[model samples]
Structure formats: structure tokens, C-alpha cells
Target chain A: MKIIYTSFIGFVFLIVCSSIIISDLKGPESLILGSWDEVSWEYERVNSTENSNLPLDNLVKKEICSNMFIHEAETWVFKKNNRLQLVKRGHEEEELIYNLRGRGNILEMIHKDNGTEIYQIQDLTKNKLVLHFNFDLQVKGIVKMTFSKVD
Target chain B: MLRKFNNYRTHQDNLKIAILTACSAGMVNVLSVILFFAFTSNVTGHYAILAQEVAKGNWYQAAIVFIWISLFLIGNFTSNMLIIHSKPGKSTYLAHATPLILEIICLLTVSIYLQRFYLNTLWETEFLVALMLFAMGLQNGLTASITNFSIKTTHLTGLTTDLGLLFSMFTKKKYRKDKKLRRKAQILLSVVTAYMFGGISAGILHIKVGYAAFYIVCVLLGIILFYDYSVLKIKRRKRSLFTRKNILFSKKTL
Candidate 1:
């Protein structure tokens, strides 16, 4: 009886595991893959005394849209080839290729330059995208972007 | 009459254990896959694809997942039933080998089907999905064998409910015999924890590396196979030695 019971469990376990793998391989690709125009991104100073103080000079240097645009960027590419490369003018020639993967709609991208850099994309749509980043300095941030298709 | 009732009770116990182990095993593999590779247990999760499929009168994909799940259940049932009838040693060997056998069969079936339907546009690119289902079936089949029927790793519905009941028991009068219950709780907790870990790990790994999850499952299956084969070989050797001695004695007497 005990042996019977154990075999039964093994069968169930395999089924669930396989289903999960199926989802990752076959489910709807997350909507974050489309192009996006920079709207807003927040960069927190790791050593700042006043956590809320936004460096005015840093904010003004970029093309800030109504106190928006966290980082200076005209366009960003969320590719299907496991690369999320940002096309920014000043940063490294290409934002260190962040390895991207997903199961269904949930997408996670890890910056290969530093494995500690994690980005999550959620609540994605044709017109809107939410980018959540967990940086290496233990600082967390969000970027809310709204897009208009450029024909 | 009492003996009959006791027999029924034992049967009930065995059934309960079987169900528990199967569920826990499923949960464990789901969680492990998610933990190790960002894979998801449910294809749609909260998505209404089933409803959409139903509305569109295209229930084939949804039915496929269901059928996959059913095969897994059937595999579990067969393994359990076999163990119930086999001699103790033979049962042990069957318990471990059945899942391996099922996986091979499933893979062959999927490959054959894909070959036949390769030209069909409406067939849908679901070969991967089929493989996933087969893998899940194998995983649960094996897990059911390893941890006994005390754990259910696939769906947490029963395990979570049982945990709630146990917690309520904590508030009631303490029984010295509750020690067994406590041990049961610990095992359930560990399996549940492993399951959650699997989910997180699969999620992260799938995010980082895609399709590698299948290789991981293959590795796990291989380990179990090696262990079972070794045991079977040892048992066969022991039996052969005993038979040889018996034959030698008969020849000496003749």
C-alpha cells in the first residue's frame, strides 16, 4: 500500500513539472517586446542623505518631459532574441545586454553585465508598459512608459 | 463484520495516501520547475483562454492539456495498482521503473504525431506542450513512489486544507498520540516548501535560460533510473546465487 501511494505521488509531480515547462515554452509571449518611447524612469542616489532629493542638474540635462524621463533615451529595443538593449546616447554603446525570458505574460530580464540587476515587466499593453528594476546597489525603481506607434 | 470494516478502513487509508502523495508530488515538481527555470504550471494561469476557446468552438488545445493531465493521472493509478499486487521486492522495482517507461512512451507518441501532422497548419505548434505534459506525468509518477502517499506535491488544494485542519487541532486538547500528526505536518511543510522553491526557481531560470528545463528533468529521470536498475541487478544476482546452491545440492544427492 505504501509503495502504491508513493508511485501515485511521483506521477502527479511529473505532470505538474511538465505542464510548467510547457507554459514557459508555449504560452503567449509577454507584450513588453514591442518598441517603447522613454516616458519616465527614477534613479535614486545610493548615498543621498535626503532620499527624496532629485538632483536638479541631472534631471535637467536630459530631455525631461514635464518632469519625466528618468534616463535620457529616445528609443529602447525589447527584442525577441533574449536581448533587451536600450539605445541611449550617453550610456555604454549598448545598455549591457539584459537577458530576457518569460512564461506566459510575465517577463524578467537580467543584466548580464551584473547578474544582480533585475528588471520585471508587468501589466503590459499596446499603449502602456511598466518597467520595474531592482539594481545592484539594493535600490529599487520603476519606469512608466506610454507609447504611440510610429508608422 | 468488524474484520470487514477494518479491511475497508485500510483500503481507505491506502487511497488517501495515494491521492496525497500524487498531489504533493505534482506540487513539488511545479514549484521546482518554477524555481529553477521561470516555468509556469498552468499555461493560462489567470488567462481566459479556455473560455475563449470554448466561445470560438476551438476546444482542442484546452482538451489537449486536459488529456495530458488525465494521462498523468492514469499513469499514477497504474503504478499504484501494480505495486499493490506485486511481491514486495518486485513492487519496489516497478514503482521506480514505471515513470521512466511512461516518459519514453509519451515522447515516442508525441514525435510520431508531430511527424504525421507536420504539414497541417491548424494542427498548432503544440509539440512542446505535449512534451511538457508527458514530463509532468513522469515527474508525478516518480514522486508518488519516492515519498510514499503522505505528501501531495502537484496541487496544494488538499495539502493547504489539511494544514488548516492541523492548525485548528493545535487549539484543541492535546493528545499524546498527536506526535504522528506533528511528523505528518513536518513532511507536508517540507514538500510544500520545496514546491514553492521549485516555482520561484523555475520562474527565475526560465527567465534567464529557456528550454534548459527539459534537460534538467531528463537528468533527474536518469538518476532515478540508475538507482532502480542497480537495485534490480543486485536482487537478480542474489536470486541466481541461491538457485545455483540449490541445484548443486540436488546434483550431489543424485
Candidate 2:
């Protein structure tokens, strides 16, 4: 009877723990699933010491983002198994492995060719995701990518 | 450093231990930051982050931070507990060394796991942070408790404030002339310098050898253990030899 009571308590504890973990209240990681449409690509200055901040445009993003996996992506689909699919404008898809660090603030995406890129999740909400990254091209500043979740 | 306790510890003993342990703390902190993007040495920032996460409704992240803080507290608790309890063997040095051994084990686990089995998941990173924090807590507890709270090597926020206060006191002639005050200033300065030196070295070493930098931390900790052990052994031998001579002299007189 004592062993049965202990087993019952353990089973209840496990159920409660998993429920809290799987729920969206866990953190930004849960709220970041499904598809997100690319809203805009913006730029911000890193520090006062850095040189004049050149504004980021479509052409500038095209030239500077060769190494960044999200450069040409239109929509990002975060799958269940640490897999991320980047859908390009013409409907081309690129698959990459993604992981979050620093309480889901840092987003690391690893390309199939083994190239990697890191971005800071500046903001994550129920319907919005903002990513911040840096570029050292002719214009040196942080690039901010905003995304709106797709239904 | 490990041999003496409380008021019996000389300034040299405190300074040496502070410098060595602070350097190790600085190195461990930088390595954790570079690898996990988290601070492992101190809990001030973690407390704030915990509150922020909770306020932001990020339960998972908040829970991880809370666990890290709890591990740090538990580590400190474990170290002091070992110190007070291990004296049953009547080995003061061994009692103190016990905490260092536990710290070494904690760091070694992280090092081995990172080298062999780390999958770069969030869980893996959080677990590594927890281990490093516990190790740091063990070190900090050992130093602070043995010194009667004079030397805390794990974090510099309090030390920096103490340094500022010491500098302010040094403006007066009496404070400047006081040997105790002078010794305190010297020790604080040395800790800051050693910590900065260790931090910079870890930065460069990380760039050169990556996560292998943790081995260097393990080596530094080993030196602390070895230094105390060697000193205690020599003292024991000298006491035994002096006792033997006394016995022989008494026999001759008889």
C-alpha cells in the first residue's frame, strides 16, 4: 500500500512537470513555432565608436548576406525536431538546424553546407519575432529582422 | 592557504589564496560566457535575469535561472558542510581540500561532457552552466568561510566596492601609515589584477584552443590543492623530527 502511494505521487509529479514544460508559458521557444512572414529588414548602430551607419536596403542585404542563411528567406517554418525551413521569395526552400542559447535570446542556424550564423532575438511575442544581427561590410551596424506569425 | 583558518590566517596566506582562486574564477567565468552566453561566476545578474524572465512570463528560462542560483547556494552549503564535518578525521588541511576536490570533480564533469557528448542543445548549455556555478560556489564558500568573510574570490562586485572604500581611506595619513590597511589594499589590488589577467588570458586561450581552456582551470585548481598538501606534509615532517630529537635528548639525560 505504501509503495502504491509513492508510485501514484511520482506519476502525478511527472505529468505536472511535462505539462508546464510543453505549455506556451514555458518561454519564447514555444511561442516561436510554426510559420513567420518576414516583415522588414532594418538597421541599428552598434556603438558611438563605430563609423557612420549606412542604412540597409534590399540591394545591400543581397550583397552582404551571402554567408547568412536568413538573407533571402521570406518565411521561416520552425519544426518540432530542431529543424528550420527557410522559404525564399520564389518558393525555394532551404533546410537548416536551429538552436537557441541564452534563454532563447541567441538563435544559431547551421546550414547544410556546415556554414553557420548567429542572431540575437531582440523581441519575441505571440505574433512577432525580431532578430538582430551584425554586418561588417561597407556599412557596419546591427541588422534587425522583424517577422509576423502566419495563421 | 588551505591550512589556516579564520583569524590565524596571515595576510600572505589570504593574499596568495585570493589571487589564485580569483584568477581561476575569472578564467572559468570567461570560458562559460564564451561557450554558453551565460555568466556562471556570480548570481547578482542571475537574480535580475530571473526576475526579468518571470515578469516577462518566460517560465522555462526563469526556472533554469532559478536552478542555477539554487545550485550555487547548494554548492556553498556543501563546501561549508564538508569543512565543518570533515574535521572528524582531525585533518584541517584535508577538510579544506575536500571542497577543492569537489570543485575539481564538478569542473571535470563539464569538461568531459563538453568534449565528448555535448549536442549544443539548450538543455546541455543550461546543465553546463549549472555545473560551473556549483563549482564556483564551492570555491567561493571555501575562501570566504575560511577567511571569516575577508576574501571572496568568486565575484568582484563587492571587492570593487571595498577597493573604492580602501582608496578613499588611504587619503588620510593615519590610514596610509597603518600596516593592516596597507596590507588590505595590496591584497585587493592583487585580486583585481590577477582576475583581469586571467580573464584576458582565457579570452586569448579560447580563441586558440576553444573549450580545451577548461583543462587549464583544472590545472590551476590542482596547483592550489598541491601547494597546501605539500606545505602541510613538510610541517608534519618537521614536527615529527623535532619531537624525535626531544625524545632522544631526554633519553640521554636519563
Candidate 3:
């Protein structure tokens, strides 16, 4: 009787671990490739006191601090072969090559001139994507960018 | 249980550590998967991912994976080095407890950082992941060294392989009847079962509590450390009492 109960539990556990592995194996590329509208963006300072004096801080304050870059009809298109298309409201579309790398939740994107952008993929679902990236200010800080899929 | 080291450890001691450490490893690994989408307790999957990156000419990704694997190795090295270099005539429990204390500190740091200021940025996530991998390395090292490599709790690949070999051998009456082999089988079963239970529990808890689930793992390690410390204290008290009685008897004889 004890052996039966124990085996039953083990069998159930095997199923759970197997399911996680299968889900992970599905890959994040498909989930990230579609068009997404930028919903919101914010920066988090790691050392707010020390980095408040940096030039990037002033630039971010003037541009992205109070006013979000939520242009009407803005869409980001991630394509195959490491290509990215950024379309802003009433502006010419910019095409850039990008490489999406890393496994699991830690993802890194390398752009042609932007060097390497590291992002923590907080959540990636069928319709929602949340990303976190950091800037190396004098004291280091992060930016949280959220996007919703555009149909 | 606390004083015994290396060859002097009994089957019961091995079993106790196996169950406790495996459950802890399971919880840590599962929580990491849910929170960071990575495996911090083991490097088996990372090695495969590293190879895949290398094959695709993704040097940056490959380098990250390589560094992660190296951290796990360093963790193991640190734990064993502590165990190997204790001053003679000192309580070995201190040496054994040192690695676990370090593990607790690592987990505690991770828990506090995530709770207060986790921005979910890549560097922050990677930093947390590295700390977790190192903590697990320390744990894996301590358990493996103390048990004479008879038990490893951090990864299931080797455990599953050993289980397969044991079950196949058990089909024969000769292998099943051997006391040592049977004991080994029992130990393996306990470790594997406890590990599964831990993972299942973490899966449920992480959903409800989010990153706070890591604190529970810290508490679990604390329990193990406290248990060992209590046992050491009792052992010391008994030794002192025995010495006092011996001294009184010798004076009377004089």
C-alpha cells in the first residue's frame, strides 16, 4: 500500500517537471515576433541620489520623465533574420538589425549601433510583453518598458 | 550526527541530509524557473543551451551561459575548500556549517533585493541568477562532500540515471538482497520523492506569493543550520558532564 501511494506521487511529479520542460522548449521567438504598440515606459534608478547628477538623467527628465513616448499608431515590428522595424506617429520608419539572445527569462538584444541591450522579460504572453533594461549611468539604473500586442 | 564527518557518517545521517537538501534544491530550482525563467540549482540544461548558442554563432549568449556554468563550479569549489581546511581538533560542525551559512546569506540577499528593488532588468536578473547558482553550488558541494558523493541534491539528471541503474539491478534477487544496495535504493527514493514534493509545493506557492517564495527557502536552510547547531551544543554539554564526573572519581581514588 505504501509503495503504491509513493509511486503514484512520483508519477505525478514526473508529469509536472516534464510539462515545464516542454513548455520551456517551445522558445520565446514566436511570442516576441509580432507587432506591439508601446503602452508605457519608465526608468528606475539604482542609486537615485548619486545618478541624479548625470547628464543622461537630465536628458531622460526632459524627454521621457513626465511625457511618455506614446505616439498614436506607434508599432514595433520584430522580423525574422534579426530585423526590427520601429514606426512612430507621423515619422519615417526606422529599420535596424537586431539579435535576440539568451535563454530563459534573461534576454539580450544586440542592435547595429546601439551595442547590447539587456532586458529582463518580466512577462511575455500572447497579447502582452513587459521588458526591463538598465542604463549604466554613473550609479546604474533600469528602464521598464511595457507593450501590448497590436492586432 | 553533528560531530561525525567523512567516513564516520551513518546511513541515517546521509538519509536525513539527503531528504532536507533535496527538498531545498527542488524549491530553489522551481522558484527560479517561475521567476527568472532559468534554472539556478543545476547546470545540465545550461550546458545544452551553451552548445546551442555556440552552434548558432551567438557568441554573447554562449559567453553568458559559460559564465553561469563557471559560477556553479566556483560555488562547489568554495564549499569543499572550507570543509577540507579546518584547523585540527576543532569541531567539524563549524566547517560543515560554514557553507550553509554562506548559502543562507546568498539567498537572503536575493530575497531582500527582489522584494525591495527588482526592476526586472537583465543585469539585475542575471545578478540574482548568479547569486542563486552560487548558493546552490555551495549546497551541492556540502551535501556531496559530506555524503562521500553518495548523494547529490542539486540536479536530477545524475540521480535519475542512478535510479535507473538501481531499479534494473533490483530485478535480480542478488542485488535486491544485498543490504547496502537496498539501503542505497531507499536513500535515492527519499531524495527523489522529497525533491518532487518540494517542486510541486514551490509551483503552488510561487503563484500566490510571487518573489516572496524565496524567503521560505531561506527559512528552510535556517532550520537545517539550527538543527545542526542544537545537536552540537547537546554533544558539548554531555562531554563536559562526562569530564567533570571523571575528574571527581580520580580525586576520590587519590
Q: Using lDDT, give the best candidate's number.
A: 2
What would you estimate as the lDDT of candidate 1? 0.47
Chain B, TM-score, each prediction? 0.57, 0.96, 0.95
Off by over 4 Å in 1: A1-35, A40-70, A78-100, A104-119, A123-143, B1-96, B101-134, B141-150, B154-157, B167-175, B178-183, B189-223, B250-254
What are the C-alpha RMSDs, in order, of all predicted structures?
11.1, 6.4, 16.8
C-alpha lDDT (0 to 100) for residue B2 of candidate 2: 91
State the C-alpha lDDT per candidate: 0.47, 0.83, 0.75
The order by descending TM-score is 2, 3, 1
Better of 1 and 3 by DockQ: 1
What is the Cα-based lDDT of residue B246 in candidate 2?
100
Q: Which 10 residues in a row give candidate 3 chain A its minimum summed lDDT?
A: A133-142
* Regions of model 2 farther than 4 Å from truth: A1-33, A43-70, A79-83, A90-95, A111-116, A134-142, B86-89
Tens digit of per-residue lDDT, candidate 3, span A22-112 = 3454345666787888776655544677653233444564565345322223687777655767788746366665443334445555445
- Measured with DockQ on alpha carbons, how good is candidate 3? 0.05
Q: In each prediction, how many residue pairs overlap at the backbone (N, C-alpha, C within less than 3 A)?
A: 61, 0, 0
What is the Å distance of residue B176 in model 3 from its true position? Answer: 1.1
Sorted into a CAPRI-style docking class, model 3 comes out as incorrect
